[model samples]
Target: MNKIADYIQTAKLESDKPFCAFLYDLDHLRAHVQARVDSMPANTRYFYAIKANSELPILRALAPIVHGFEVASIGEVRKVRSVSQDTPIIFGGPGKSDEELIGALEHNVSLIHVESMHELRRLNELCAKRDTVMPILLRVNLRGPLPTATLAMGGRPTQFGIDEMQIAEAIQLAKSLPHVKLEGFHLHSLSNNLNAAEHVKLVKYYIERIKGWAAEHDLELSYLNAGGGIGVNYADLEDQFDWDLFVGGLQPMLEANLPENMTVLFECGRYNTASCGYYAVEVLDIKENHGKTYAIIRGGTQHFRLPVSWQHNHPFVVVPSERWEYGFERKGVEDQQLTVVGQLCTPKDVLASDVTVPNLRIGDVILFLYAGAYGWSISHHDFLSHPHPDHIYLGGDDHV
Candidate 1:
């Protein structure tokens, strides 16, 4: 049985207003993360990227399972600290204000990914002012024939990391800086890459490049941060990223090529938590417009914006509502193509585009899956100033 549907039904009985909510299964999230961690090879670590979902409950649930948290801002650093004061944090971002750098230093961040020469200089200065020495990974924008993914941060012109050609110069400068220590390289190239074989090949390429750099510079680095791009398949949930195959291919390559002392780091965000969440909204109206059917819900992109941002019809299930308090007949559509939209004023407030559904009604609930990661975190919550959806957690001690 669908537990989320039961909760939505109960909520509907308790209130007359149209409703929307983000429901997270904490037990599922914990188990999913644990499986990922357990499958990792020796000398490899998994870091949960906090930018995906920094909700306190999510962080608290993930803290015990992950090796550490990968944070991109001072606010994220503080969020992690609030949950686990001593949890290791790897701070990585292109634009870091002096205050944020200082905050990372004060919070005792385990490793900071330095993006540029100027940023490196600034960090060294800050450390010197505090009479402290900090460990860092020089984020490199690799020059390459790289694997194709949904989004590419490197292998092109971007404001993400230092260029590959400039890495030698950056290293020499880091050697001169008294308060900053260079530990390794951060090569986070792609986002939402689903092909497992291609991903393994990419990792192999990263290792070979890092090894060459280490030998040339005569350095013994502690880590090779291959920033995570393992993706979840929203188009077809059953055809997910092949973790077993990826691990099978990766463990052998790491054992053969990578140094025993160094650790390989993966900071995954979407794949870690996306499957454990569902966005539920009540359909308010069914209408026909220019030979097309549209079902308008109580929520909009303001609440959950992943589908619109990606321009893909997010996968969902319609939970039929049995109760009808209206004097008029309940209106619905059956065996027709439907476009699920939200209650926003703009025409772009669509969740799922023209897709065929068996049955849908005015009071039915639409529950969107794979919403635990970028769904809420990347949304413009105050766009139309609609009342926020209820954030409900299930099956965990921290449930509320």
Candidate 2:
């Protein structure tokens, strides 16, 4: 009956399984987003980038509160479409086809973040046939290397936007076409900014550039979108956020240069919606081998897709119950180093390489921390044929 050997001695347990819950701190995410929205000087708007985590329940929770959505594909556009129509959805990507453009415009989407002249002509043909003007914000490549070497090297030389040198030409083209409005200027740098200073630098660059573009062209800037690259707190740093400073970093530039009545839009994904989620998993087996104990969890990289992409570094922790120690005792004897691994075919399928844990018997619950941003569906894929993880919205019911 020693506490160290009992399985789970707690009373308020939801299930007798090791859970894979991605704890969503949505309020915090919303607060972070709203703070950015409210602190802006003038015409500024925000579009929650939905690719980070497209959990339905998570999107359901956020859709009503957000100003708009930034979708990269037709599927994502459809996702937002099913929820709300009033919330403007802007579709942005480099390889969109005529069908996708038609779908977006069919829904009366707020904006099309256009990448090329061919697409502009296509939109003109599509809209002229439909007798409508498609508002667009040209994505310009402003990714001129960040301060960090690793992150700078992490980004590929991509032409996702209308390159900066083509700005004036793009504007002239937009006006001459008669079917598209050059509504705003959009520039999203790569997401590897190690700090906020570079992001601020980007915002300042946009403000100055947009100001000059608008003044020279008499375009009357309506929207100035500062693209999203807000880093998350997956690093486990004690002070994960520098909120006041982050908000302050771009606020001054926005306050100084935004055009009259223009809404500044932000396409934040991980920053606005990632932290407010939890991934629950059940422990399948525990064994000691070669001086290293392993906690093999049931799910694989197919369920949590980031491991396959090598864009993952999430933290894992046990849900703290009043009788957590007793729960561990019921499982086994002494605490040990538990290297958590997935039921994946590849030898590299590791959730966490090394973790200290109270001796866990089969079926003890494990909670992964900071998994809110990009956990399950974004984890890994190929061969498992597993269904995507079920989203369990807290303050609610059993999703499975």
Candidate 3:
């Protein structure tokens, strides 16, 4: 199959609009997800986190492969349900309204991860009103010396989960609640932790802690939801998480140590989808300022904002172009650092800075790879009234 970026570049050449688009390769997505699924050991399940890329076609393409989905809001619940009827759904977030709780109960979601004692009580009351039992996993803010990560939430006091000091109290409260069943704990501590061994170690810590709690409370937990923070190498495009090494380390450890009755679930978002998407934008102008080359593109952070959020030089390739119409000498620089900026008026709209690339000119396309996950969804599309780039789907004949 053609590289996703190359395919997108061909499509961009055929289009008349300002050359920019978010292209998703369904074939690549399917293969990537399937490989991850296949690598996982038995008793472990995979759930696609819909917050990564909630596009209808992306959801539909992934529904059949994943066991279920992890949604943060009621709208996501509905969206997942629209694509899948039988697949299980798990709801988790810092804040959830009474209406959302009721809706989740009505939909019979597989599990609602309780973020705090208050949320636990709220869910209990909501379940009581419906006269139905609600299954839940306590989202714990593990007070820890966790593995170093790009973003760490578990070891600190964050809005994500219950404090580690209160687990015993939370367990007693769970016992008192009649409608809510605390089946296990959700330990989602880090974001983008790349080390496979470190991830395995984190999971081991979660199991030991949860097992100790279950034994102390004399409770038989069903599952431990390790909130997914699987990393993607955004800084180096060729580098990726060593899934083989991860699985190799994880399986043996689980086989020897993990409790036989408990199952593990990984609700991965970015790692599952990032590799399949590409964002391509055409250079509208090229100029030199203060000994620095700047290539301004038609679109900026409004359409692709992950680079700015991560503050990394997002990897890209220069789709070299020879199309030049100007009678005057064209501006071109070779083997020099190029700072890529979007059309947004603000200076903070830079996508990449001080990156060495081939000479660039007006009409040359810069295709940003690995933009499938948080590229468009987290962007400020309406910030400056810039036209949204076409969201094109590759691998299938459909164009959006």
Candidate 4:
């Protein structure tokens, strides 16, 4: 049996309540991230976005491999610092408070992605107060004929970054500010972009645009922050982001159009960590309601909210368990389509919908795949005050 199945079986033997836990394969994570880092072209860097999974074990595993970390809040910055104090950190988010800005500055963050004109000024003012000159990347909301992505933070009216048309003005402001140094532009417009060719095309577009802007403004820039949106195929695990294809296309583009001494940075969250994590919950009950069958699990959206949040049937496997402690007829459904739900009162507590499962019993564990990123970290854990699932890490230097 695979590690997930093996772990589930072991947990069933140990626990009588229900097996609900997040199992992270550190060996798999390290191998996957190392492959991605090794495959990147010259002058290219990969920064793991901590918003995906901020667990300490995950951070420690990735610290040596990734070039740096991309954080959204001060809390994330502190988390990275606790793991590796010397690792470079780039802060980026909307509605950043004064304390967050101060924290970023005091913590010696390598870069801060300025979202707006007011934010730029605010950061500049904060830097002046500290008597420190800070390097900043002006995040631009490009006006583009861009490719379709799962989520768009730019190329539209969103509370993300400065408008492309107003970028020139923002650059001028940054230059005039005494305490802030303009590094480059951050064009992280898309989220969950699956097409490798289209992503390479987007990178080319970013390079050309930035080159034009540098010439026009006479701006000496070093970093080009291309936000990470490489997507995961939740529907089909077999179909995934072609990293080799992307690198094949990207290497030539960077070598041809990239400016001299410019280091292109990719801050990827989901793509790096999603595959190495699994959310396994034991089945509490199995029954047919009206015409459809419902296999209720011990956990729900509160534990793993990716399916309901994305409105897609997350991929999973039913780990069969032989142990049945109840003194009654064992409930099960064989070769039938079922909707997996959690033990929540609301109807929205769904994990997988309209999925066909063969031989799913009441005691069997449902292991949801591709759950490393944005699973437990983004969930409402306090909802209904249910007991939180145990976090189990497997096969790493530090296995806790």
Candidate lDDT scores, in order, read 0.92, 0.67, 0.87, 0.92
**Residue-wise C-alpha lDDT for candidate 1, range 104-218, written one tens digit per residue:** 9999999999999999999999999999999999999999889988889999999999999999999999989999999999999999999999898998999999899988989
Question: What would you estimate as the lDDT of candidate 4?
Answer: 0.92
123-234: candidate 3 lDDT, tens digit per residue: 8987888788899999999988899889988887678899999999999999899999888989999989889988999899988999899889998898999989999988
Better of 2 and 4 by lDDT: 4
Q: How close is candidate 2 to the true structure, as a TM-score?
A: 0.84
| Best by the lDDT measure | 1
Rank all candidate structures by their lDDT, best first, as comma-separated numbers.
1, 4, 3, 2
- Per-residue CA lDDT of model 4 for 39-77, tens digit only, reads 999899999999999999999999999999999999999
Residue 193 of model 3, lDDT score: 83
Considering summed lDDT, which 10 consecutive residues are worst modelled in model 1?
391-400
Worst 10 residues of 4 by lDDT: 391-400
Candidate 3 shows a clash count of 0
